[model samples]
Target: MSAAEVTAMPEGRGGRMTRAQIVNAALALGLIGFGLGAWAMDETFLVTLATKVAILAIAGAGLNLVLGFGGLVSFGHAAYFGLGGYASGILAHHALNYTAMFEWPFVFEGTTSMPVIWLTAMAVGALAALVIGALSLRTTGVYFIMITLAFGQMIFYFAISWPAYGGEDGLPIYVRNGFPGLNTLDPVQFFGLVCVVLFAMLGLISMLARSRFGLALQAARQNRQRLMAVGIRPGGVLLVAFVISGAITALAGALYADLNRFVSPSMLSWHLSGELLVFLILGGTGRLFAPLAGAGLYIALEHLLGGVSDHWQFFFGLLLLGVVLFARGGVIGFLAGGKRHG
Candidate 1:
């Protein structure tokens, strides 16, 4: 068959493929092919890497809610990350020990249910964001950045000093959390779970971006005065965005904790917050799937470079610096050509 015929056949079999459809199909095939290859070699490392990509992408999506859509540059999202992780770790510990979380007013017991843990994490994260966003939103520019950073550091130190859950030592999740019938310990199963969460978050964010509220949030980000003059409260818009962003990031934290079967204060550190920001920039902020692309590329680079040398991080840093200086749009922009707005 001719090249055109071969291409058309794949598209026809794929059922009316658009650009996105073709890209997604290619990605799916690539992943399936890679998984089969890994299985052949008795290796699951790539599966783990893909999980990392999904988890990070989830966090990046949360960040994108604020940074990309709301035009808020928060330098302290690691606070939510660490908070979500600690929430899971603490609950799992209490449940495993069959102990009550607190006896002051009411009884709170831990369970192995993923949904319950995720809800708790999201709630805690939203509350934290509400408080932080309230204070941070009072300022703009450098002051806003500094305030967010301070809040993040505050949580980081608190986690380090808290004697519970091993304090600085971190807590281990002895068993993978249950999700109905799935054996989460299985790489493929866990990977599937991650993919589901990532896609769900992507769909939700995409919908939000197209909603009236999302438009207001974007308007507030671009020109707060104009939004206010148009009868929209910018502060309210920002607050909602911040809360949603935190919740999404928190969800990611829960998954990440399960992925490693552990939680540590380091998860809430400033470095992780910076890394999330880096992923957004690297992937092209505001693009729906930029985080996924960026996370995949970052993890792949880390894996390949680490295998090559011990000082790979230094090279990674240099490469990132080059990207920042020269590449205005990042991986998605490079792949997709230019930015498109709705």
Candidate 2:
């Protein structure tokens, strides 16, 4: 194959593939290739693994808005992620059991529809983020971080004690939720569905990042006082970003539950929240394809190192340390020659 055939020639502003854009395009194509290869090999497990990376990438993308652009160090994103999972699981549970979600609320019933589940998950995630952001945004620096962490823990403990939906044991979703015209039971089909959502969200984030609001958000992060001087309310901007971030993460959570056929308090754990952050950092915070890059690398490491030793995480930590110490711009930065344009 010729070089032109292998490398994507997608045009950018100057009719050239900027380093960052090239990196993003390459990562996306890599994911598509991985998924296709898995399907071709009849490796359902690999297909499912690809789906996991896409789903987690969605969550990481959500977190990146606040952490990367808005400079918000929220440690409670797991609350929203877990909430999204519970939303889908609980709805599927009630649907399976033929139970009403509520009687007074116009006799609402549970749904197995993927679209419905996703909408509900986004709403719930946005609401939770609103509440969390409203309170957490009141502080800054370590205070904001601690407050977010505390809220996440609060949700975690609540889920553990709530016996209605399996409590500490978690809830099981027997059947995969149905998409409009897809056989969700088929791993390849399910992976495609996830890939679509992931790409759509990525496009949405890319647009937002380039839009006027995104600029303001970034400015607020760089200097809230300057933003205030320029007539923009830094708090409000940050709050909106946080809500959007939460909703996106929640959607990932919902998909993740369906992927595993299970939802549990562990999803709400602080470790998961940290993992989301790690995904963004590992891939390249603030970059468009950072989430995918981070998630793919993380999963690859987990599989390879996990097979060799249980203490893989110790070595993983060392690699992460190296990335932090040397390649501060992350995988994308390292690949793009550390120019940091995106």
> Which predicted model would earn the best TM-score?
2
Candidate 2: lDDT of 175?
A: 96
Q: Write the per-residue lDDT of candidate 1 for residues 127-188, one digit (tens) a residue.
A: 99999999999998888888999999999988889887788999998887878889988987
- Candidates in order, TM-scores: namely 0.90, 0.95
lDDT of 2 by residue, 191-290 (tens): 9999999999988887777677887888887889999998999999999999999999999999999999999999999999999999888887877788
The 10-residue segment with the lowest total lDDT in model 2:
1-10
Best by lDDT: 2
Count clashes in each candidate, considering only residues at least 3 apart in sequence or on different chains: 0, 0
Ten residues in a row with the worst lDDT in model 1?
1-10
lDDT of each: 0.81, 0.89
lDDT of 2 at 302: 96
